[model samples]
Target: MPDTEQLTTTTPNVQTDAPSLPNLEQESWQQLASAADSEADPFKTLVVATCTNTGAGARMVVLRQVDVIRKYLWFHTDARSEKVIQLEAFPTATLLFWDDKQQRQLRLVVETRLHTDDYVADDQWHTLGLGSRKIYLSERKPGSEQPAPYQGFPEQLGENLPTKEESEAGRKNFAVIECRTLSMEYLHLSRKGQTRALFQYEPESKQVWLAP
Candidate 1:
């Protein structure tokens, strides 16, 4: 096989073709896009870092959709989640994604814009299957009460999935995280090689495919 690090010898020769965007960025995003889907990898989530009223915190969330062409991403969460509250108070948030198989890490700085009401929330809600929709069935709001050794689910039959009747109520729980990407940095470690690159999309424009 050709050395991917040496794009001049690789099949795609992407480095020579696009001097701005690194081939590593292109490859990683391609992997992410290919892996991102409701069925393919439902739990393929990123650890989102959102600032709190006092400090920083992070939580894992399922990856929703990726727009490579326009450079954007989306994720779903409960309306009452602490992350949501923090995001509303502080729109500046950062997303961290790690691909274990690829040994790659991506850091993205974005601005959050809630997608509620109108067709936005409805469209996403309609696409969710019954199994995934179950998350919206929680009786108490997320991060709300604390009782004995609780796993955060209401006491009931247990195996709970959103029913047709509860779907409407779920509409209020639905939230879309719109990430207006400001910059994306990529780092990859491999047995054969390592690579690092930083991409800037605001204030000034720059991209580099460098030695790691």
Candidate 2:
């Protein structure tokens, strides 16, 4: 029988040679920044889950920014989206990240705050490219149905980029969701065994390994 006690790797920035709870947490923060900047990083996109009247709602969003010291995360969304409404009502959410290359999953519990017309959103908006800004220019609110299947953006524009003046309309719909992480749960799967740990940041800081 093949032994389930060894593993090999073909990815970068994944270390299992000396894995520890603190080391794993440190690597997660570093990878968050790398993921945002590097297109090849699998951690660039995360699943954000929010509370809904029915149950739970989840969607994939690009990881835009990371604040390591403050343990904050940032993602952009349309101000009129259902997720925004859900967050405004619940304030607390979970961010789930899975790295297929690393065979690991990181779940973060966070308190969310919306920034629509504030400086935070304004600053981030200025950094966005015209392509990204155009997404917010839809005539109808996000998730709204159309009579004859309307494209999200104006069909007249087609593949052509919108002018700076034309893109200004999107600013009103643009928002930044700032997430302050309260706790992080890390799980790593390996052929030999599995490793799991929990890091608590709120109320008091603590770290403990868990059985996987």
Worst 10 residues of 2 by lDDT: 9-18
**Per-candidate local distance difference test:** 0.75, 0.90
Candidate 1 similarity to native, TM-score: 0.80
Q: What is the alpha-carbon lDDT of model 2 when measured against the actual structure?
A: 0.90
Question: Where does candidate 1 have its weakest 10-residue lDDT segment?
Answer: 12-21
For every candidate in turn, the CA RMSD to the true structure comes to 8.1, 7.9
Candidate 2, after superposition: displacement of residue 84 in Å?
0.7
lDDT of 1 by residue, 47-114 (tens): 89999879998998887777887777888898878888899999989988776766878888888888
Give a tens-digit lDDT track for model 2, residues 69-174: 8999999999999999999999999999999989989999999999998899999999898999899898889988778887789898999889999999899999
Runs in model 2 deviating more than 4 A are 1-18
Clashing pairs in 2: none
Query: Which pairs clash in the backbone of model 1?
Result: none
Candidate whose lDDT is highest? 2
